[model samples]
Target: MSFKNLPLLGTAEIIGALNLSPKQTAAAANLAHRVTQSAWRRRPPHKSGQTYEEFAAAVSACAWLTMFEVGALLILGRHHDARILTEASRSVHQAAHTGRRR
Candidate 1:
C-alpha cells in the first residue's frame, strides 16, 4: 500500500497491511493512542488555535508514520530508529510505571 492508503485506514488496518509482528504492532498502536490522548489533553484555550481533537489526529498521524519506521527497523534489525522508538516507549511507559509512586 502507498501513503495515500494510510489516511483511509485505521491502526489495525495499517498494522495488518504492514504485516508487523504482534509486539511491534501493539507498541505502535499504544504509541498512537498515547500520542493522540496526550495531544488532546494539551489543547489550549486561545482565540486562534486548532481543536484538541485535530491536534491529536495530527500527532497520531506522525506517530503512525514513525511506527512504520519502527516496524521496518525491527524487521531489518537496523538500529537507526530503534533508539527513538525505545526512548519514546520508555517515556510513555513511565507515565504508567510511575503512577503508583504518587
Candidate 2:
C-alpha cells in the first residue's frame, strides 16, 4: 500500500457543459441546471445545453480559476482518494496472489 504515485487536487472538466431548457425545473442546482430564456435564437441543445460564441466583436477571452496555482497551495484532495485506492490495491494484490477479492 503506497500513496507515492498520487498527487492531490485536480480541476473538474466543466467549461461548456451547461445549458438552460425551455422550462425551469423544480430547483436549479448550478449554472448547468438553469433553464433557457425565451427569444433565444439557435438550435436548442439538450436540457443541459452548452455553447459559446465562435466570433466576438473584440479579441477572444480566456479565463480560469487562479486557485489552481497560487502561493502556498496545498491540495487536500485526490482524483481518486489514495486511502481507498490503497485498500483496493491491497485487495487486488491479495487476490492475485491468494485468489480472493477480500
Candidate 3:
C-alpha cells in the first residue's frame, strides 16, 4: 500500500508537516506531552480569591507554555509513529481502519 495518503499528519502542519528528522520530531512530541500535562495540572483561579483582572494578570505574568502548540507537536510525532494510533485499536475498535475495499 502506498503511504502517500495515510492522512496521519495532524491539523497543525505549520511545522512543515513531518519535514524534520525523526529524532527532532520525537523530541518535539515529548515536549508537547509535557506541556499538555502541565496545562492539565494547572489549577484554575479560585472562585473567591481573585477577580478576573487579577487572575488574568497573574497568569499573564507567569511564564507559560502554549498547550495548543504543544498539542500540535504531539500530532506531528503521532503522524510518524503509527503504532501510537494502532495501539488504541485494541480498546477502541472504531479507531482502526483496515483499508479494505468493500
Candidate 4:
C-alpha cells in the first residue's frame, strides 16, 4: 500500500492537549526518530520502499498509533507526561516500522 505524502502537522495544539511542554515534545520526537531509524535499518529492501517512502509509512503509522494511545489514556485517566515523553512514541514508531516491513 502506498502512503500519501502527508503534510507536516503543527504540534502546538497537540502539545497543549497533552499538557506537554515544547521541551518534552521535542524529546519525544527525537526519541521516536531514533527508534524509527533503527527499525528501518532492519527492514528488508525487498519489502520496503526507498528511504522516503518507508520513513513516511513509519511516521504515518506512528502518528495514528500515538493518537489512539493518547486518546485511550486520556479516557482512562492514565496519561502521564513523563511516560509519554520517555517511551511511548519511541515504542510506537519502532513497532510500526518493524511491522511495516513484513
lDDT of each: 0.57, 0.25, 0.40, 0.52
> lDDT by residue for model 2 over 58-79, one digit each (tens)?
1111111121211002122342
Every model's TM-score = 0.38, 0.22, 0.31, 0.44
lDDT agreement of model 2 with the native:
0.25
Which candidate leads the pack in lDDT? Answer: 1
Pick the TM-score winner. Answer: 4
Q: How close is candidate 3 to the true structure, as a TM-score?
A: 0.31
The full ranking of all candidates by lDDT, starting with the best, is: 1, 4, 3, 2
> Model 4, which residues run further than 4 Å from truth?
1-10, 52-54, 61-102
Give Cα distance to truth, residue 45, candidate 4, Å: 3.4
- Model 1: per-residue lDDT, tens digit, 33-73? 55455656666565127764456445545455665556555
lDDT of 3 by residue, 1-102 (tens): 111111233313534654655555455555544543454456465534554344333432111223223434455555434455334433343333343333
Judge candidate 3 at residue 95 and give its lDDT. 34
33-78: candidate 4 lDDT, tens digit per residue: 5545666777777846658456646556446335433543444456
TM-score of 4: 0.44
- Clashes by residue pair, model 1: none
